[model samples]
Target: MIRIGAVSYLNTKPLICGLRERLSGIGKLSLNLPSRLAQDLAAGRLDVALIPSVEYFRATGYSIVSNAVIGCRGPVWSVRLLSRVPIQQIKRLALDEGSRTSAAMVRVLLSEMHGLSPETIPLAIDQTPETVDADAILVIGDRAMHPEHGVYEEIWDLGDRWCRWTELPFVFAMWVARPGVDTTGLAEILQASRDEGLRSLETIASREAATHGLTNEDLHRYFVENLHFHLGPGERAGLQAFQEKATALGLVDTPKSTL
Candidate 1:
């Protein structure tokens, strides 16, 4: 049976709705941090994983196995950068250890937009933002949903920043498989799972809102307004642009091909 790994973040709910039931006999699904999922996929512990987009570029023999992705056209409320200093003046930054793609995105934005390359330290998953003593801190997933109490120069929703700056969508993660894995019919299964999640957004929001310290309406709006699941032409273009930028920054290698 196929062993699949997915992110444990609320943002990933839409991509995995009813996925376990659908894969009951075909595969087993495990929830983990995006970083962990990537590591697991690389170590051969997982046959398939919803990995960070940057990991896809860095991996030597991985292939995108599904069209469904976690992306944003405009504002994505879950990935944030909180700064005590101005954007151009940030000299020290703390990156969320649970992230891979977002960490790369933040670096790319800092380099391209502000022309600043700051010293970055990892904010361990068990540590809170308040505990990090950097000029700025990047946080992703559920913790980012609730903004830090003290703020200063900027609070950037990375998705909003990328979309506004590039005029294109930002894809965070997608289903990928290691080399030699037989992915027969996997794309269709993933697509159907995404469809089921989209259709059940309201129910999902209702069930998950309070757990994430958000109102049901707020969560629902986030799913419908902030996020996009399909990897259409626009998304593919954006993904390509991102890869190009990341490659130029030496964050990842040039991807061999598309999904």
Candidate 2:
């Protein structure tokens, strides 16, 4: 059976909705953090995964497997950088432990936009942003959807910043398979799952809102307005742009080829 892993973030609901049942006879579905899923896929523990975009750049033999994606055209409320000081004045940053892509994105944004190379620390997944003492902190996934208690000098929705700066949509994650894997009909299954998920957003929001401490309306709006689920020409361009920037910044090695 194919061992497929998916990200466990709320944002991924639309992509994986009804996926388990659909894959019942053909594969096994599992949920994991983006970083862990990347590790598992690279180590041959998983045949396929929906992993962070940066991880895709770092892999040598992975192929993008589906058009369904986790992306943003403008402000993505879930990937945010909260600063305690001015952007240029940031000297130290703390990154969420669960993020591999956002960490690289934050570094690229800082270097490109402000020309500052700040020291970075890790903010454990269980730790709140307030627990970290740094000039700025990067937060991702469900935690980022909620506002922190205190004030900051600047709050950047990384997707919005990236789009405004590059004029392309930002793709956060996508389905990928290890080299030599048989993907003949996998793409269509994933795409169909995405379509079904889109139609069930209200049910998904209602079921998940309480778990994430968000109102159903707010969660539903977030899914509809702040996120994009398709990988098209614009998203592809943005992905390539991000890959180049991350490569130049030395966050990831040169990619073997485009997916």
Candidate 3:
């Protein structure tokens, strides 16, 4: 049976909607934090995963299923950079450990877009907002939704920043499988899953929000309107551009395979 690892985030619910009912007979699926999924995929503990794009560079053999993604063309409110000072004067930045792609994007932006070399520290899971002396802290997923009250003077949306810098969309994550996995079957399954999710978005959003104590309207807006699930040509171009800048900054090793 195939072992699939998925992110346990609101942004990912649509991608996995109805998957439990549809794929139950086919394989075992596990939900995990994004960072844990990356670690498990690296250790060969999972056969497939919806992982952050940057983790693809760390894996030696992996392939992405085409036409599926966790991405956005404009503002993605979930992944943001919260700062206590202006970005230009910030000296240290705390990066969320859950997202390698967003962290890398932040580094690329700091060096290429802002022309600054700020010290970036990885935030620990239990670390409080006051633990770091950094001027800004980068947060992803739920943490980003609610930072410490009054700690941040400005919240820079990463997707908005990318749009301003490149005038292109941003892709945060993609469905990836280990090398030699049945690519055709995996692709078919993922595409079907995405379609199923889109079809029942309302139901998924309502149930998820009720369970989490979030406003259903807010969750619906985030899933259907704010996030774009497909990785089309524009997003692909943006991904390529991001990789180029990351490679130039020596943040990622040269990617041996195409996205």
Candidate 4:
């Protein structure tokens, strides 16, 4: 059985909508935190995963399924940097362990975009704000959507920041398979699931609201307006830019074609 790993977040629901119902006879599918998905894929515990983009760079021999991605052009509210002071004055920053892509982006932004070398600290998934001595805390996923309800002095949307800096779309995640895994059939099934989710967004929103504490409207907006699931030319250029910056910063080894 093909062991496929998927992210357990509200943003991922649309991509995997009706997956459980349709994929019952296909293979063994597991829902995991995004960080764990990368580790599992590297360890051979998973054959394929919807993994963070930076993790794809860290590991080798992965072929990305065509035309599928978890991405956005601007104002991705879920991946944000909450700051106690102005961004220019940030001396230290806390990064989320669940996201390698965002962490690398932060580094690239600080160095290439902003011209600052802020000290970066890696924090656990459940770490509290008090644990950070940094001026800003970077959080990703559902937790970042609300951020202790008004505790932050300013919230910087990473996607928006990237667009402002590079004037291009950003891809946060993708469906990747280990080398020689043969994801042709699996990719078609996943595409069908994504299409189903897109068609019945109301149902997906209701389910997200019930489980993730987001309102249906918020969930719907996030899925429909805020996030882009398909990888297009602009997104590919953005990915290439990110890879270039990451390589220069020594965050990634090299850039493989995502075409």
With a 3 Å backbone cut-off (N, CA, C), the pairs that clash in candidate 2 are: none
Q: If scored against the real structure, what TM-score would every candidate get?
A: 0.97, 0.97, 0.93, 0.94
What's the residue-level lDDT of 17 in candidate 4? Answer: 81
Global fold similarity of model 3 (TM-score): 0.93
Assess the local accuracy of residue 146 in candidate 1 as a C-alpha lDDT between 0 and 100.
86
Give the candidate number with the greatest lDDT: 2
Ranking by TM-score: 2, 1, 4, 3
**What do the candidate models score in CA lDDT, each in turn?**
0.92, 0.92, 0.82, 0.84
Give the residue spans of candidate 2 off by over 4 A: none
Model 4: clashing residue pairs?
none
Clashes per prediction? Answer: 0, 0, 0, 0
Per-residue lDDT tens digits for candidate 2, residues 157-255, read 998999999999999899999999998899999999999999999999999999889999999999999999999999999998999999998898876
Please provide, for model 3 over 1-259, each residue's C-alpha lDDT reduced to its tens digit, 9 standing for 90 to 100: 7888899888888888767776676777899888889888878898889998878766687888657789988888888888899888889899988788999988888787779878889887677656877899888887677667787787888888988888998888888888777655767777788988998888887888866657888888888767999988898888888878788888877665465
Off by over 4 Å in 4: none
Per residue, candidate 1 scores C-alpha lDDT tens digits across 38-99 of 99999999999999989988888898899999999999999999998888889999999999
Off by over 4 Å in 1: 257-259
